[model samples]
Target: MDWRPWLTRWSEEWIGCTAPDELDPDVVRDGWLGFAPASPEAVAAAEERLGTGLPPSYREFLLTTDGWRDAGCFVSRMSDTSTLDWVRDLEPYWQDWEEPDDEEGDAEGGPISRGLLISLEADAGILFLDPGDVDESGEWAAYSLFSWLAEPPTRFPSFIALMESLYAEFHEMRRPEGATRDSWEAQVEEARRHALAGDIDAAEPVLAKAEDFGLSRATVLRAQILLLIGRTYEAEQLLGRLLHPSFTPDGFFADPLFAEEFLPLLFAEHARSSSPGHNSILQSALIGDPPELQLIIAEHQARLRRGAARATYGNPEFDDLVHAALERHATDPDALWRAVGEALPRWRPRSTDHIAPVALLTHPVLADTLTPERGRALLSQPRGDHR
Candidate 1:
């Protein structure tokens, strides 16, 4: 379908785009935006809808605000365990979202399940999303995203205000009596009040209610608030769900903007001295990683064969580790080989997928250890690890 032209009409009529000068509009004929970058509003909405509170970071993300972040599908349609847990608790209302259709229906439908993530692109340099999925009014959502992309706002205040204004209007028209919408506005007010009074606890209740109002982007703001207050686990959980690779485009990852914002703390918060677990996974990400470091390692390795991210593994930030790994591997082939093998488990490493082929091809024991035989063998199975 002519998504661009269609988006133009939709944006003007639904999102209050009176003229082209008010917004930029376009058609994403090719390329993509990293999926599921994370939305503070969505997280908050999800929580309030379920009558539960998300982790402090997630909630704080909602309370906090920003303009543009990474958008588009960077992860697969799969849900991380944490997301699965939250969704298990919220499966009812999300029922409206399309499930992973075993039969890929039309170009417009996009991925199978909902709960998508907004991730970062290694090279595309723009955020993207299914014009149909995220937009409340499919055509309007598409149009609004187009307009924003055409003329990306320079400031967070403008971005937040613009979306808030649009969503507020969208909700009023679509769900006038829905307590969910009313609760969302109330929560925003509540969060504002709590912040003013310095009673963060008081803010929690309203933030909780706001999320119920279908304002998932609030999670982004709330996560910021939680981080400011040092509630890392909850923040991790919310961000984890927000950036999990499973929610993005087929080959996309997490949002670079989100990574830039959280990486400093992410390392200190989740890294383990040793072993490939959650923390490692989150920390090792050159760009898009989950909440923990080890899990980062595990997930990156799982995605090694993706040609698009060939240089991800040996990111400049990670060169030291690679150098160290190279040195250690050179000195102790056995130990190094063991680590390489360890990297091969279920998930792929970001380094291996995007690192220069020469660098990876040069690893003396890489071919021997991460052999196609073994790599294929390990990944060939019908694993439910990420998906």
Candidate 2:
């Protein structure tokens, strides 16, 4: 970065060490970081490999200077400082970034990811980046930081101590001379950071037992582990109260509600085992908010449409239906299958594999009237084209 004069001054004064006149020229150079956004040249190079231009938004992220986060090695004492994670994906943009002058090739700067990513290894730890040198992808990786050095262990700061230190820091920040409301909020935020980091052992007593503590939120989060292990009985025991009155089912479960596994488990017991109005259950849960589960159901419906030829339909939650559909769709005879995108509640994305296609042949209109070739003709043309 040409802004080195001020950086050197600041680093020297604050870091208590000499700062280089320039960023290591090797940190971001030739476009090597895997999964990183690509520059125009890098994109041109990748086109040679993948055989297509990247999606425009992805391309713009790699080339435009909107400052998105980049992934890289984060070595820093400040656990809360997102610089390390920010730079993990952001380093390429930081170094390769240039401003375009003309459309051809006279650009002064290139694209930046989404944000400026600065990785500060611990306060006392030395930054191990090679300035601007890059791997094949044009950015640095966390592994290179260790591989480049014969002795990288010395650079590995005591992560546990650092975490404990953060806990202590927030403990202090939350309680200044007098405990004001804002201080209480700050304390909870720090606790939340620790909880997200899975510091249950450290956060339990202080967060769960404190008078103005964050027990409710913490409980819902901690219960996630139970949900993950398929111990829904236990998880439900922990979160069941909220389904009734504690955290407001709308807000407490908002996040996990969109998650494929957890959401199903949280409401598995509640969904009607045998019912119809339940179709609208998806509606109410998504009121003001959108229904993401609707996609899962629609996907299942898609699979049913593709799996049947004689209007043969059945349950999905049931195992027999699941196996039958799987086999039928595997050798689907009908060539006319309709792929539709039903509106979802929360827009949760699922893979095509899990979201198996349904059989339109099962629909009476097609099964009762149209033959396979006619169905094929129907499939070839979009409904809008015919209309």
Candidate 3:
């Protein structure tokens, strides 16, 4: 899609919404958000100098505006044709840092050593386009490398896609509702409130949208929603992205809902799958936990070896309940699950936040109870009203 109109709109909205202190003095004085378009000769010179043709979206961007201000919250300026150069030439030291192997679908090293640097000023990050990985439409893969991000550089399909994501991040931070893109933070809060109240159906879509806007917590919330609807595999896949050997149950992880509900669901999935790919995730995650948690993992592993393994929710009380339910040996697991679901709300946590433990609604035992119609009814009901 042509980004000129949207870019112009984004610039205007940014100029209108940004505070005077944050706006560049020149921008405020001139009431202009971008530089004059680059001449064909200038564009040709950069392409010839770099020995690779510039991608269409970026080339079109230069034709629209040779340079741009506030490309994102951190990028103070975008390179004009005159200033654009290869990342290797501009920052050769980038090649010295060892590139990690690709995890999941994340690209290795982000091609930083072989990319076209697009941004002129990056306060804490750099934006580059990888000409080596082009799509059918000839748009190069774009990357946003941030200093604080522990993982590989965030990749986009094209320059336009990268710019759109940056713009979305801008909207997420500024919350300029009714100005450009919808406010992702607002959507996240709305989804959180709904999910906590046991309205997963209502919350799921908003959470999904917030996830698209780079809200990490939204992924967690959406995973819970997926679990509530009995989509255990999908939920497991989503949570897998967030899980790492070094994951700490601190900060947001310490939240009562996340600690009590989400973690258990993830651990349960790990035990059930025991796939070779994720075997190490469980091993690394359990290291340095409380002695009780360690014992649980050890016992679970022993049971797995004996071919008599059972899923545990990672909480002692809940595990006891699960053991009791299994001991009953009722012919119908669904009936047993329904009983467990009914008791979930009363399962108190170690934390003070008495926000209804909706996370328990995702227990593997209760999956059978979350049939489409029943799941919708269960999730739509207010907290404490689940049958």
Candidate 4:
């Protein structure tokens, strides 16, 4: 198939504009994101060195753009025609299963031969053509090898077919829906870096700019910033809008920004809230803490089930103790109770002891496991009285 025109159009449409000097070795020697067509002489030299004619589509691709950067997957710049020495460089590493295996004394069984065609440095993998696995047109079968997997190589029909598959996958990752300008994406990335570094002051301004452009990701980041600064009410309100059914109707929960960043903040804020009603807001919104935290809470409730437990509950420092107790008491209920008993001696006489523990007991996981009688009994325990 005439792949040159198609490749050119794809490059222009997806890869964006290219300068005339982009193809110059000096220009792209450091790095580049697109392609530069090679001379016919250069292609001929590579073919002569490999002793196999390049696949028709790949050959045409080179005629249009000699090598590309990140064509698909983690593939770096394809080897320019002049630097086609990877074939020779990788010969020693190739296992010739055609011959008998001297170590195992087995002629038929051993590591199979893999003809390496392209090496992807960042991905730690290679694209190869297997002579033994050819197609009707005499094109070699293409395969991919990765150092991370012990299984057999993944196979494809031809180089062009492999490229096509990679392109499709790359497009999916770009999230073409509601596409934004490259500049907008860059601004969002910069904002995220600031947010991650705990510099909300710096991040908010940049995110505001991206939000002005209607970038949904920027909204998510802003929600994260709000949560970080202890603005749970505002964060949840914004998230409700950004993640509303009408706004992100299709993949609201599945968006990585939501799942990885926003959701965790929501769960943590719920965990930290002093008001049972405020904490319940998350449950009413159908948001739950992660399973690990839920499991820890369940175990804590089990200990509370055993007997009366003591904890200092009326101060800000007690919040830290509540978080710590939830994590520390799985098998050693005695230690947890002892820690709480130790804190009680320092508790002020008028301080409310029931609030934090009662709040915890009312968590959905715990509340569901305990009968109403049992829950009320645990809530009535007078362990916090110093007398």
* Best-matching candidate per lDDT: 3
Please name the candidate that would achieve the greatest TM-score relative to the true structure.
3
Per-model lDDT? 0.37, 0.33, 0.67, 0.52
lDDT of 2 by residue, 193-259 (tens): 4443335344434444332232344454445433332344555565544343423434433342223
In Å, residue 231's CA in model 1 sits off its true spot by: 3.0
lDDT of 3: 0.67
Candidate 1 TM-score, true structure as reference:
0.25
- Candidate 4 scores a C-alpha RMSD against the true structure in Å of 18.5
Q: Estimate TM-scores for all models.
A: 0.25, 0.23, 0.58, 0.39
Residue 73 accuracy (lDDT) in model 1: 21
Query: lDDT tens digits, residues 1-387, model 1?
Result: 322332233333332322334332331321121122346566656656545444332233233321122121221122221242322133323223333462166543432122122212212222122223333222212112222234431121222233343445444333334344555766675564444333555555566445433354455445544543445457567655545544222222353323323443344344333265534425434345344544544554465445334232333544445455656776665666455444433222232111111233324354334443443333332221222
Question: lDDT score of model 1?
Answer: 0.37
Residue 114 alpha-carbon offset, candidate 2, angstroms: 69
Stretches off by above 4 angstroms in model 3 are 29-31, 98-110, 181-206, 211-224, 227-332, 337-387
Rank by lDDT, highest first. Answer: 3, 4, 1, 2
Each model's Cα RMSD: 22.0, 22.0, 9.6, 18.5
Model 3 agreement with the true structure over 188-274: per-residue lDDT tens digits: 767777765777767888877676555666776677567656676676666655553222223545455554566555556566667
